[model samples]
Target: MNFTGVSGQLQFDLEKNLIQPAYDVLNIGGTGFRKIGYWSNSSGLSTTEPETLYGKSFNTSTRTPHLYSVIWPGETIATPRGWVFPNNGRPLRIAVPERVSYKDFVSKDKSPPGVRGYCIDIFEAAINLLPYPVPRTYMLYGDGKRNPQYTDLVGQVALNNFDAAVGDVTITTNRTRMVDFTQPYMESGLVVVVPVKQVKSNPWAFLKPFTIEMWLVTGAFFLLVGVVVWILEHRINHEFRGPPREQLMTIFWFSFSTMFFSHRENTVSTLGRLVLIIWLFVVLIINSSYTASLTSILTVQQLTSRIEGIDSLISSNDPIGVQDGSFSWKYLVNELNIAESRLVTLKTMEDYIKALQDGPKRGGVAAIVDELPYIELFMSATKCAFRTVGQEFTKSGWGFAFQRDSPLAVDLSTAILQLSENGDLQKIHNKWLRSSECSMQLNEMDADRLSLTSFWGLFLICGIACFIALAVFFCRILLQYRRFSPETVEGDVEEIELPPRSGRRSLRTASFKNLMDFVDKKEIEIKHMLKRKSSDNKQEASPSSDGKSHSPS
Candidate 1:
């Protein structure tokens, strides 16, 4: 058969003696053109070669012509040649690791082998959202008997052994150099896993938040406030004035009792009341903070790890565990400058748990350093037997791997970003990691305590208020002493005066009479002086006066 510009001529070989139509005309837009067969060259096609074609008839008035196009058997065209799905379909070969954890992605238990898992679910979901159909086949890369390194799994895609590699493979510089990676679907980082130790209850744990010095200083300030209140009120207020021993006892009792709000004594003087008010406020703040801190200490367990962080691991003589062939091994040796002699190589999550349980002294490591995903998975399985400590370091994330410059990489990355923006990625993570059988144990090593620094401002304000009250009381006492001292000195001089006498008896009697009369006159003079002084003070205080008093001095 031969075809030309939408019209073709068909002829049968005389040797075969086959009968067929001589000519057939077809239009692009006419009805009755039904597809019969398609010709696609899957291999060895060039620009100069004739393009593949489909057979159809356009004329309803004539019988459907026998349609045929040149094609080699078992050959087919690729799907969605650019961004659109081909009329037929394209087969996508995906590479996956063969380990038990990753095997779910390509399990063959289903009718024709179906893919399912954290990674596979994401990939399938992304494909469904595409503009066209993409039929895929998952090819297991490693032998089922042994686990493979993520590097080896990704290398298969780099070598074009498969179209793309998808799993928990993390994106790293070395891997990126050989293959392109989509945006990370899972956040990843390194963490330290340590064996859980029993936290013994301390009898005095309530006092752990504040140091001994802080307690002692706090007690001293309480006594000091009490003494200040006593000094301001001792002479005038009966509640404070007493025998030296009784007063000393009262001061200590009131000061310490304020801590518990149990003081029964009341302040009668204004200055004393002011000092008590400031002291009460200070006590209120201190007591409140102490109660909060002590409550936290009692209710929450104090978790302590033998090794606190990566730096601690590096500085100590104790051995540490690093997964063999992992990036962490290189990180410890090169980046952290840790000696290989102090390093113990671990291979799997089981190894990590075993090594930590055995301890550093017994042929095991003090801590295990591995990726956070693995640590989380381990904790999920072991429950409270292990916990992750320290900050996540050497940050990286897990992503799908593809051949360098592969066209699929861009589309896959865009799909992943869209999935993340729409919250589908988070839902997948919750299904896999959050809903897993293993629950994460809480770590309390980082819980904070209330310290003196948190309430020092309250104490400072109280101290200033107390000082002002003390100053006002002292000034009032000094002014009263100056007003009364001169009158007492004048009375002493009047008592020493007496008139001359002849006989001792008459002289004594006359002197006594004169003394009585002089005492009466002096008493009258003192009364007049007191009244005049009081009236003068009132005149001076009156607002109507300009600069002088209206009454005589």
Candidate 2:
């Protein structure tokens, strides 16, 4: 993302079917796929667009009409771990066990550490579907952190060939005849590039002729406006002819000046000037009519205040930006094959955030990041600093990559399944997304929402107080009856007939009668001994449970 200000991460452009092999009929890249994507249908009947469990498109920000969307693959019950055969091009993701995250705290980076990203979400899901310990450090290239060198310096040598096995081998159609795949723990692309141009501290350092697209569009607009004025002058002045017509001269100047930055135009033969004037007026009028249309194409139009999308950032090639060596970069590189010299590599998302605040042109990395929403914020806080390129390039599944054939994947997946079955998956979602202090603040935004001050514990406390008071009141009434009419009925003949409601009742009655007079009679007398301490402003004090002397009011 090229968005500026906020240091965001993980705002990836997610498109369905961007996977390496694309999508086959057997795969999910086709029309059947949906993502942070949407689906809708309309005909003579009606239209529908349902909300998925993520609440994506179900709210006011996204006016998606109601439609039926599936629950998350890992969250759903009755799912097959790996192979149930995809239907309607949807893969069934069944994890073995569900694991909720620690929702109480956010890391210093503002992103959750220990637990993070598509990997965390999909890893938990994959654990339920696959056996674990899937894989160890396969191989490493580039430096592990963003220091003097961001990539693993010695390349594969850094990892000691833990990832040496399958570098380049093509597959024909042989099952048992050759090397095999353990199981695809994850399916996605890989990339990390260098920006082609040097990033300037100030984002707007270069704009003379303006961008190529802007120059063309602006010139055309001016020419069209001149043409319109020329037509109007001609319409009314057809009956007279003169070397100096105010309207015609004004139109000429406006259209001509739009050609370049020079304020004075002195080089032109009489015939050339005439030709230039007529042409300028003609073009200006034509361009004027299409201003709205031209406005849409110019890059500057879209990026007036801040950078708009990912492409501008890449094309700008500021040295400041970097992304992980994930498939997104690979698409921008080897596959998309952006200029190699332009690409810069960073080890993690952390580096991307740190460099975003430099002067616009300083680092030359106008924009850098994988996550989209996070970037939106990152750029916003930076005074609308960067921009984005366009739509998502590819869509792929993210899961915990494991050692080729590890059973631990199965165990983890089982744990995920168990959690999901018992509603733990949802609990985790609510916990992380809703329990934040941010949520508490948001709740206070209106009278209808719950706030931190209105926490449920407060209500529970009130209820307990009421219950205790009621219990005391009832006990008092029971004791009063024993004292007021002890034996008025002791001689009643009817008591003889009922046998005093014996059995358990008789035992209860006897206990109540014996306790009628039994009570804690010791008086806790309070003698007000006001003592003024040296503090001048006296505050009430009392003896604490530990017998510490406390000052009084």
Candidate 3:
């Protein structure tokens, strides 16, 4: 059979020959990853070459599963005796499961530490992160699907499980619950996903320091207020240095006119004008810093942790959230000896990410999460993502899970250690270290939270707020202690009532409003009557003064 020079046939033959190897490589991505080496020349990851390989799917439910085999290099094939490697070299082929090998085409996870497939690793690592002496864990088991048996579990009943059960369980109910939730573990609660009808206002942004717009408004308001006060009180048409009754009338007129005539006058003193300018500065500059601090627009919190380390999270009474069934969730509720009520378990990675952003149940959350890569995945999808710090709250050993408490746990750990000892762990780690979601950065929230520095921003924010409040109170005290009224000190138009703003709603205000309404109505009626009389007079008069009056026909 001379096969030569047939282009169509040749191409077909080439493709046919390539198909098996390609399929094998696609299935045995782990083996191909090894052959490809640890670092890709482009991405700097050996196994995760092209980066997207880890997220690829098999397109079919995989069966071969890339069963791991520990082998020696260069099998010494005797005619009959069987496999052997030379020089006692341990040539290993870790048959990574196609569903879980980070390089496998069927794997969907970007981070191998917390994904459902990664939980076994996390469990192992978290166990190791603790101070030995494993707690006899009584795990609450569920595969995340609805359990027909727990039909009675609804709202507070399901939520109350947190109190009744000894550990964390993910919640899915949406109706309001009377029971309190711990931090989220596996799922976020309900969401209202609707397109914004209009551009929405920033949430509580007013709590932030003054914006440039606000600063401008503040400057204008203060300047305008001060100038109006200076003009009406200091340089008005009325006589000053006088007694009570006349002074009240002058103040009333000033109070009324100054609102509109703020910019109309030029009688304000230089010192008074300077004071207005200073007030503008305070409004513009001082409040801007205040607003920024209050709103927390700065990502300085990202640079550090809220609690710092795993130890802090483990030790604190603070409620912690975890993606249910995750290593962090397991460790905190089990090994760390945190109460079940202290753990909030969410159902999905998305919910867990959201729970982290939602923060603590008691004003703040202390969470245990996969240290870096897991957080990076969240930042890849959303802004204002959270972080973990302080010695990786728990280190997780990445592994494919089997049915609970299976002997595969130990076997897999042994296999993983074997791979680690032979540098496969480094290879895997290096591969993941380059993905954008994995590589961006990490917030050692705990480390930073506990560090002398991260707490400093909070200290400063609180300190400044306290200082301002104290200053305001102290200034008011000095003013109050003296017989001088606020009307004199700031040239305020309103009379200083001896009582607090809370003294009463002021029936006088209602009476004054009613009196004004009556006067306005009477004035309108008088004008109408006068117009009618004038018309009648024009119809009846012959002459007035030096003019003849015309009569209506």
Candidate 4:
């Protein structure tokens, strides 16, 4: 159907078959509505405009009504034909959940016969923002003995037992199917809460400074340094020269003692001393890091939860707690595939604390699973004895509930968004849920042990230094071998020691291994000759200058 006039044409589908009509209309406000002139039915009975549609006229009568006056942005004008209450301005009946899981949300005072809480404050604030007054009375929904089910409270509104329901009502898909929910005032989601315990002492706590791979790498480096130093020093240094078994034992002893700077053996070769220098530097860093990590472990108090996340709870046979009538129970049983027998229903904040503290073995739950708002409220109210584990498993929000398609939902949602933008929401939240105890931070150092990554740079530097020294040592050995070879021997290069006639003859037929042995023997002989010359000099100096030489003292 279509209507054309001096005003723009209004087109709509008569059969509702089009994907989209010329206009989409909602009854809440006229800020977006356009006037397409007027219509009249001369023989029909009169009808008043709906209370929701702000600018459009729904009235029909025998006489023609005036055309709609344009309503501009930021302006609201009264309709010539407006709705009036049928029952003499009776207050709208609003249901407030009684004995809610957390009393901070909503609580009815019997002595004063009134209801007040964080939710009540927000509801009043939102209603005040609406253009017109919404007179309403709070009727408690459940008996004081037990907390009321939120779904039941919302159901009453669907059945028209109440004009609306308020107080920490969650906006969920199933609930929204029966009622409309305003924009969420409080962002929320499901979280797991578990009691935090001090880490227990372990007999092998000493090994925590380094991971197993780090320990193995460090040990390998130690043995490598020892062997390299022995190779460089054994020919010249008496301390390094020994029987095969003694030399092998010395390698381990010298390597392990370098950690404490207590090795008795001394390096005589420059290469041996250079290797020790780099090894000692690397050991210093490893020791310092190990000490710092071990000190933090021993001196600091650390808190942790046994339950890491939803998966841990699902796999365990232990009982888990949920608010008595919350959707969490259904999510755990149905969505997570957990056994119903493993769930424990908790009715109050005290119940949550008691159940968690007692633990699953003592007829209580190992953890409490609930929405963030309720969990945060519980955390703020108590000492820092519990903590949340992992991310929220489910996403949802808290909003006020109204009968299906109620026009008030849109305006109320706008008011809530305004509150959020203007900072009133934060102030309200702080007034109820903020606590100093919740400010304490967890110690991350407790769980992080040292790994090879932390000291890889030091290891790299030491390894490079050893390789460079070995390269120099190998080059000198190659130069000596070339100089002694009969064909390569040059007249300008003076030999330090001549090979025996038989050894020289053997060298002509010697393999690479035999040549290495000949070089080793020559170096040892040179060291011995130097030592004997030093001993002769000392003996000559020791003799007295008298004609008769006394025994050398």
- TM-score per candidate: 0.68, 0.28, 0.28, 0.64
Q: Where does candidate 2 stray beyond 4 Å?
A: 1-320, 324-329, 346-360, 369-389, 407-553
- The residue-level lDDT of candidate 2 at 491 comes to 25
Q: Candidate 4: misplaced stretches above 4 Å?
A: 1-87, 110-113, 200-206, 226-306, 435-447, 451-469, 485-553
Report the error of model 3 at residue 203, Å.
Answer: 11
How does model 4 fare in lDDT? 0.75
* Displacement of the residue 334 alpha carbon in candidate 2, Å: 0.9
In candidate 1, residue 53 scores what lDDT?
A: 25
Best by TM-score: 1
In angstroms, give how far residue 239 of model 1 lies from its true place.
2.5
> Residue 303 in model 1: shift from native, Å?
3.7
Question: For candidate 4, what is the total of clashing residue pairs?
Answer: 0
- Candidate that beats the other on TM-score, 3 or 4, i.e. the better one: 4
lDDT of 3 by residue, 1-553 (tens): 1243432112234435421112121222224342423322232322333344434543333323332232323331122123223334432211112221122111223454212333233234433432222322222333334211121222223343321211112232321133322222122221111000111346764434434554454344444444344333342222421455754555455333433444333433343344334444443444445644543433333432345455666666766655433345444455667788877655445565555545565343456443244444444444434433434333222223222233433444454555556765555445443333323233332322222232334334433443454455336434432433223322344544646664455646644544333222322343554466568677667356325445454
Per-residue lDDT of 12-68 in model 1, one digit per residue for the tens?
Answer: 475654223222222221223423232222211222211232233223335232343
Worst 10 residues of 2 by lDDT: 521-530
TM-score of 3: 0.28
Worst 10 residues of 3 by lDDT: 190-199
Clashing pairs in 4: none
- The TM-score of candidate 2 is 0.28
Q: Higher-TM-score candidate among 1 and 4?
A: 1
The residue-by-residue lDDT of candidate 2 on 1-553, one tens digit each, is 3233343222324664221111111213324554333332211111322212323323444453433333433334343445332333332221111111111211112343233332244344443445212232222222323222212221222233222122111111221122222223233322222222222244432232134454465455455545443432332233211344754565667556644423243322232234445444444543443352323222231222133344555556445344443333444565555765665554433455445444245553544535333343333443333444445444432222223343443455566566557776566545433321211111111222222343234334433433454455447545543443333222222343345546568656755654433221111110111112212223333224324544453
